[model samples]
Target chain A: MFGAEFVPLSLPPLVIGSLAAVACALPGNFLVLRRQALIGDAISHVVLPGIVLAFLVTGSLGTWPMMIGAAAAALVAVALIEAIRRIGGIEPGAAMGVVFTTLFAAGVLLLERSDTSSVHLDVEHALMGSLESLIWLDGTGWGSLFDPEALAYLPPELPRLAITLTIVALLTAIFWRPLKISTFDPGFAQVIGLPTTLIGLGLVSTAAMAAVAAFDAVGSIIVIAMFICPPAAARLMTNRLEIQILWSVLFAVLSATTGYILAGYGPLWLGADNTVSAAGMIATVAGLILGLAALFGPCRNRAGAPLGA
Target chain B: MLLDAFTLGLGYNATLVTLGSALLGGAAGVCGTFLFLRKRALVSDAISHATLPGVALAFLVMVALGGDGRNLIGLMAGSALSAVLGLWLVQKLTRHTRLAEDAAIGAILSVFFGFGIVLLTVIQTMEAGKQAGLESFLLGATAGMLKSEALTIAIGGAMSLLAVLLLRRPMTMVAFDPEYASATGMNVSRIDMLTMMLVMAVTVVGLKIVGLILIVALLIIPPVAARFWSDNSDTVALLSGAIGAVAGYTGAALSASAPSMPTGALIVLSAALLFTFSLILSPRRGLVAAALRQLKYRDQVHMRQGLLAIALQQPIYERLTLNMLGKQGLLRADGVPTDLGRARAAKALLDEERWRALRTLPQFEAAAARYDGLTDLEQILTPDQLTEIDAHLNRPHGVPA
Candidate 1:
């Protein structure tokens, strides 16, 4: 079932998609609990300014600094929204709209102002990422780690995915108890001195990491898909957080790999060149999975629970 | 710029495009109010993103049919169809599935956008000529717009205007208090559909100017800005339209000034700025009003404190201030001054103390004594009230005093 060609294309997307999925799923779980699902969307858009500023400062796409820059921008986006809420007297969504849209617009204007040689991204192209490109990134970077003949020979994107997954996993492991207690009852958690603010900040930073990782894999437009879609689909099937995480991981890996392959064949089958990108297609499929889960997930009786109820 | 428009031949085209864009923005603003209230602001994003594939497919179909360059009609038709399909899918998912409303929104938005990306890529590689003008729907181009295109916008804009006008009563009733509307047999579901159609139409019309990613800004910002000024729905809707129109015009003109500028981002920026202004300065709900209210309350507290000092008549000096502070923090009740404990005697001593004081002369003592005798007791709590407060504070948690 898993042949040589399959090992290269199918195995890599699954491995990377699973890592990326696990990373986002943890933050996605808390985001839903916070009733700030769109925070991911806002953070994703706001992180662009940081990425651009980081590039200007460093003049290179070095991973750690870029990630730090993006995370800082995401934190600033959160702060901006809170400031707008306090100063502008708008609700979270309106504040988010104002802060994120303006920041994203500023990011675009800055990109336009900068030289093309430093980075080659238009606003639209930056919002979308091509996963097919990830499949063929430098595959011989780790040759010295093994005997000269038996090199590591892994894709560059996969290592980033792995690193991101490790960070997500470690954070989740260290903060699982606090995250759960805080998410379920923030007032009580506060009374108990649980440091909900730190947990909330940590969740936001994790989401930023997910956005940065998924941004290269799927782009900003569809990162929301990977970030929100799997957990959402899994949500339909179960109410338990553990089950939701498991199912989200399962759904993201399955959908991304399947979407990538189907998109590859879209031109072959549909007569058109299948302009449908693998990331976008994966997002669509993940949405479809969520839709199906919504329809058939066992917890139908409680589907209409009103906000704050 | 307005004078430049008068001199330059391109100015005429700019004016025409501005008018159309303004109308589109106004219509989007009015419709977006209902969408925002429905918590579907991002729906505009989904519908806008989804339109790419619709436009691609529409153009491909038109090409295969040997149609002329008037592919905008097909594209519009295709966008409308896809938007409705996307809305339907969202509704179905929410109604039938265990997924939350936000999850449904995210899911639908991503999927449709993904499909649009796929379609655009295919068009890019295989049948490039067929979709020559279709890329405009992604980011939008105002320079190429003609009178005919403006006419289409006007018609769509007018239709949205009419829908808002005709359904104003039920729409407001449904948006504010849907349960009551349904209880009153107003066909809440029908009203919802009608408003959704209006919202859908606005999304479709926006394809010409703001394009996909930023179309929601047109619908969202004007209403948000207008919200600062009005409590009544009628005023909100009207102000929203006005703001929307102004933003539309400003963004379009800005983009026209520099051909390289993206029109969608300019429109979004204008709306966001306007909304931010309203958020800070609106009449009732704006930040300035809240700050003023807080300031006025502080002044009242200070005035009351000054009056209380005169009534107490306890040497109104730094020693009295220190004594008062010590009383509030006592580890021993014995530390409270005996003269401070005697209400009637305390007032007499305060009166005598004020008369002896250098600040007030003997001639003014009569007026000051009378004023002091008038009592600050009216503002301070009675004995019974103080006992009730102490009882409440001393009461156990969860047991009423």
Candidate 2:
């Protein structure tokens, strides 16, 4: 399994998926605590329309315009949700529901209206993400790890996701105090001179950044699953935010690695030839982890926890 | 072709799709009202996405059993089962774990859908899956739909609509005031379950028409739009049904008129169009109505402040106030009050004096609270009460002394 073909086929997707999963999971800790997990879901869904609009505007499947379009869409979705909630006096959840669904439906309609068969732009591709096809074509074996020549040909998502994950991690570590304070008690944080509103906005913006970067690699399913499952399972495992962050990172890496392995080889073990969707398998594994945590984790119930009650 | 489809002259299958989608829309709208009222509208989203795995599973199972996997009822049943499981998992997480409801919803939504996507890939690899058309459930496909399937959807929609009508009273009561309903010998939780089940049924039934992803739109957009037209729950429910029906009919017709038009997206877009119109045009709560009301109030304030300035012989500096007074012939171009302006100013002064006197009386306390400077004293106070207050006014202070 560690032969020439394995490094070429499996290493890049695994690393990219793991990096993307961690990228989503880091911000997810704060979001799950703040009861804003759905914002990730909403942001991911609205990215569809953004990319579709981008494609129609530029008439190319270039990654930068699509990523920019997705980021703009996320911002638009957030602004729209806020606008609808304020103007229509609609609840936040319902407002988010209306805005994201409308945008996603519009994306679907546009995709159908425009001719996209020649490009790799189907709803399935958009949803499942061709993670398996993101192969390291130039690598020969495990020895390619030290080869700068082979490294130069690595999929762009690896570097992009690494940067995104680094930025998200740095943000988390740098603002750990304010994030925890605001997530726990906004009024107290405000009384103490913390910019609670800006802090909240920054947190959401960070999550959006993570979501947009991870979307092209693992798809929205893993983005959403990583956002909720790892942190949620981590939340159940411990009371301290620091330890919870550690646990969440651990869980995210585990889910991505195991899920990719299972998706690629689990069917073979069961005597089947075809592989399943890695995005789906990753999400399922994350859910299974969360389910296990919910069932047997030390702090699963809300006896002493004050977060997300 | 589009016009013929809209007029229900497109043929039997197209007509069936249009009418069935309308009935489903109406039912979804009415059922969704209670969900929106309860502020858990996205619960339907989780349930809708949860149906995907069951669809693939149902197809796989049917194909294994030596029958075609295109049975509408079996697919619906399978989807319904999974949606219920998803709903149950959400409820379990919310109730049993430290997870908030929204987190539970997100968890269930993504995870179940991810699992479903896996199943879809699995089915795709199978021999029978080549023509499975399972992707239709993702975004419904209406082309070459069988008669039996259309009839099943129509009958299913009508039954759910009937069920919604029968249960709207209790569901509305629970949604509006759950504690009160629970105290008044109603099972609020059971009613909530009923609401979820109805939403789930609509979701499963709608899978072939509106697709799972946008089914929540049919349930959500109509009620939200209807809310602008009325505050009364009953009116909103009925009106929501009507709006949803219209959107459904129009969307299905449009989908049939073109080759590329998707039924679900068109349906959602139609509903969103109605929502946009309602947001702008509804007489009571719409944006235009709110702006108009504000404008009327602002104009009245300007007129009152301008009139007060005239009564006191104060120079009117604000342009809007001056313009308003001039337009009413209350002030001249030289900023002098016309005779009509002066007379109205004097009456305004007298009304202010009457209000001041009334505010001092303990018996007129409730009436005094209604005072805005623009409100006519005569409108709120009866003539007898006004006379009593007027009797208490300072004895004609001579020449503004």
lDDT of 2 by residue, B105-135 (tens): 9999999999999999999899999888898
Question: Global lDDT of each model?
Answer: 0.69, 0.92
> Deviation in angstroms for A10 in model 2?
1.3
Indicate the docking level reached by candidate 1: acceptable
Given candidate 2, what's the lDDT at residue A97? 85
RMSD of 2: 2.5
TM-score of each: 0.80, 0.95
Across B72-179, the per-residue lDDT of candidate 1 in tens digits comes to: 667889888888888887787667665556666666776787777766665666544554766677656777787777677767776777677777788888888999
- Identify the CAPRI category of the predicted complex in candidate 2: high
**Residue A183 lDDT in candidate 1:** 88
Compose the digit string of candidate 1's lDDT tens values, residues A10-60: 556656665666677668877765666777777777767777888778877
Candidates, DockQ: 0.47, 0.80
Segments of candidate 1 deviating more than 4 angstroms: A1-14, A53-66, A86-89, A113-118, A135-156, A185-193, A265-276, A300-309, B1-12, B38-40, B68-70, B129-133, B306-401
